[model samples]
Target: MRQLKIAVVMLLIGGLLTTAAFFLAFYTAEVQRFGTVTLSEEIDSAYPLVGVSNEGLQYERPWFSQKIFYFHVPVAEASFLVLILSAFFGVRFLTTRRKEYDTKSRIAMETALTFVALTMITGVLWTKASWGVWWDWEPRLTTYFIMMLLMVAYFVLRNSIEDEERRAVYAAAFAVIAAIDAPISFFITRLIPSQHPVVFKSGFATSNLLPFILAQVGMLMIGYAIYVMRMSEERMRERLEVAKEALED
Candidate 1:
């Protein structure tokens, strides 16, 4: 109970911090200009929104997609981090063959998937706002989309198997493989020419870092809160199952 109280507190704190970050992004953070066309590009080129001007200043970049950074980035990072957590638990379950660890792994994966879904939704919004399109078959986006499918497949595979031990083992094995996509999703652009902006290639503006950090920490806290809550719920369900079995006996 005390732990659950702590989880609740954590959730509230996370929500507050994320909200604060969202507001700060618009008010205090330095607005960033994303692109300036190279000298090779004609000064009188058709793409006027990007390129250096005669006055020697970068063209005004849009901030509409930038606002999504606070929300989308945090959630996306949280998803990847939680996906690692789930994979770690999956490893633990395989070594231990313990139901408790399996339950933890399953719950963690579910939480990861929830965050991934949020990431995808926010990503699409960023896509529309920034790229002016609904969807694209780009490498980075495709990588995550495949990652989500693999996660869903892991559960479906678990459901198909009848034996408890076998199900846990198979799910654990699949989860580790699924996590490969997590890193792939992150670094996909580095390996190839891609449209996704590489934020770290140059670095973030000093003013942008604070809210970004705040949002990241908040998202991590929220992810933990969710994992803890799900573990509690799974425990309760286990207890109910035991009671049912006892009644039948």
Candidate 2:
């Protein structure tokens, strides 16, 4: 009960902080600009031509879609973290053949799927808003889209198996594979040419950092809350299962 209470409190805090981050991004953080807009008239000209500027209607680009970064990047990071966690617990379950570890692994995967779905949704919005298109088969986007399908396949594979132990083993193996695939997706996108922005290396303004950090922390808190809340529900379900077996005996 106390643990659940703590989870609720953290969930509330996460919600409030995430809300604060939204307002701060809107009012305090500097408005972010999209990709560099090349000027038609000033290819060999001054430094002023690089930005999304309005040089009397000839070179004006709208600075939009930057607002999505605060929420999107954090959730994306959180999703990756959860994927690692799910894979870690999966490895542990395989090592020990323990039901508890399997439970944790499954729950973590559930949380990761939820986060990844949000990442994809936000990413689509960013793509549409910035590139004026709903979708593209860019490297990073393609890798993540594949990753989401594999994640979904993990559950599908589990449901198809009748034996509990076999299901757990297969799922654990796939979770590990998915975990390996995620970093490959991220770095492979970097190694190859892609339209994706490498935000860490290119950097954000100092003023933008605060809200981004706030959103990241708040999103992780919400993630932890999700894990804990799901664990509690799973434990209750297990207890019900045990009660049914006792009645049958």
Candidate 3:
């Protein structure tokens, strides 16, 4: 019950922070501008070009798409964080041989999977909008793809093993390795850059930062809430198993 209350409180905080972040992103952040435009010749005067020099047209994000950056970045970060948690729990399970550890690891992995999916989706969208491509073999994209595969493999390996104890051990080993590999993949991807720039230097404006931070805090809270809820459920299930064993005796 105490754990449940803690989970609920964290969840509430996460929700409020997320809400605040949303408002900050939309209302407070300065609208990102590409560049200024001048009164041009015969072409469409309303739209501003990247290098074209124009003195008249106002420069602004052709769409509100830039706003997505705040949410996207935070979510991506959260995904990696959750993935790390999964790996940590995996290690704990392997060392302790505790069912609770396995349960926690699985729950964390599930949350990580969801966040990673979100990151991929948002990343694709951002690429299309900002880079003019639906997909590219950029370092970040490639690394994230591999991370996704590793996550999938983790589950597959778990499913194939019939014995619960063996399954947990195998999953723990895989999770640890996968977790180690994810950052390596990310780092290596950056080292061998393609057309994509190695670093994006566009610093967020104050307004944007507020919402971005809020979203991050909120997302993290939600992630914790999910883990706690899943932990509680697993605990209950364990209790039932114990009860069944008693009945048989």
Q: Which stretches of candidate 2 lie over 4 Å from their true place?
A: 35-56, 59-62
The C-alpha TM-scores of every prediction are 0.88, 0.89, 0.83
User: How many steric clashes between backbone atoms does each model show?
Assistant: 0, 0, 8
Candidate 2, position 223, lDDT = 96
Better of 1 and 3 by TM-score: 1
The alpha-carbon RMSD values of the candidates against the true structure, listed in the order shown, are 4.7, 3.9, 3.7
lDDT of 2 by residue, 54-173 (tens): 542133344657889999999998999999999999999999999898899999999999999999999999999888898899998898889899899999998999999999999999
Ranking by TM-score: 2, 1, 3
Among the numbered candidates, top lDDT falls to 2
Error at 33, model 3, angstroms: 3.5
Candidate 3 per-residue lDDT over residues 1-249, each given as its tens digit:
799889999999998898888887778887665434444443553455445444543433454666777777778778888888999999999889998788888888888898889988987887787767999886677777888899999999988999999999999888887788667654664567455433245455577677877898899888888788878888888899999999999
Record all residue pairs in model 1 with backbone atoms less than 3 Å apart, i.e. clashing.
none
Comparing 2 with 3 on lDDT, the higher-scoring candidate is: 2
